[model samples]
Target: MRCPFCGNLETQVKDSRPSEDGAAIRRRRSCQECNGRFTTFERVQLRELMIVKRSGRRTPFDRTKLERSIAIATRKRPVDQEQVDRMVSGIVRELESMGETDIQSEVVGELVMKALRSLDVVAYVRYASVYRDFRETSDFAKFLGDEGLSDNEDT
Candidate 1:
């Protein structure tokens, strides 16, 4: 592995173990030139995936982007990094298991919504506000009403 600190091509793996979720192998390495240490993860790639956007544009699927979006949604919530990582890994596995190289953006969004709804309702609402593109308070009200986020009893 290349050294991220000094750009050295030579690095020695000091330790290797399965990740918390067992979805990846975590390796601790040290650069020969700089002697800097860092960690890297190795995961099994079932296939090269592509995402089809709403505008008909196609782009390579990025796990970082998916994780970042989920992280943003779950930030300051009770959800921890392990849970988020597991969720991301599970979603990726599901997508790969679908046996399709090309996946729709809408499908990805729905998957995130479902995962968040189960993980944390506040995070779910936060993600929905952006994903659903709420324009006003009424939009939130309507969404909360539809999704059962709002209280059922009258004041």
Candidate 2:
């Protein structure tokens, strides 16, 4: 491994173990030249996935961005971090196993909506508002009605 501190190409792995989620391998290393220590994670990439945006543009799939958005939607909710991670991992695995590197951005959004729907209704609604670009209160009302959820207005 290349050492980030001194740009040295030689580094020795002092310890290695599977990550908490078992989705990646974490390795602790020391630079041979600078003796600096650092940690790195290795994840298996089935292929380089590309997202075809609605604007006729293409961008590389970013897992962290997806996770961040989901986290934001679920923030302050009763949902835990582990459940969020599992949803992210499941979505990634589903996309990878589709056998096509190019996927529509809408497809990804729908996947998140479906995953969040079963996890928490509030989180699902939160994600849907952003993903569907809700612009008014009626938008939320209609969505809730369509989903068979009641809106209790404390008048």
What TM-score against the true fold does each predicted structure earn? 0.96, 0.83
lDDT of each: 0.93, 0.93
Name the candidate that leads on TM-score: 1
Candidate 1 wrongly placed segments (more than 4 Å): 152-155
Count clashing residue pairs per candidate. Answer: 0, 0
**TM-score, predicted candidate 1 vs. hidden true structure:** 0.96
Model 1 score (lDDT): 0.93
RMSD of each: 2.0, 3.2
lDDT by residue (66-116, candidate 2, tens digit) is 999999999999999888877898999999999999999999999999999
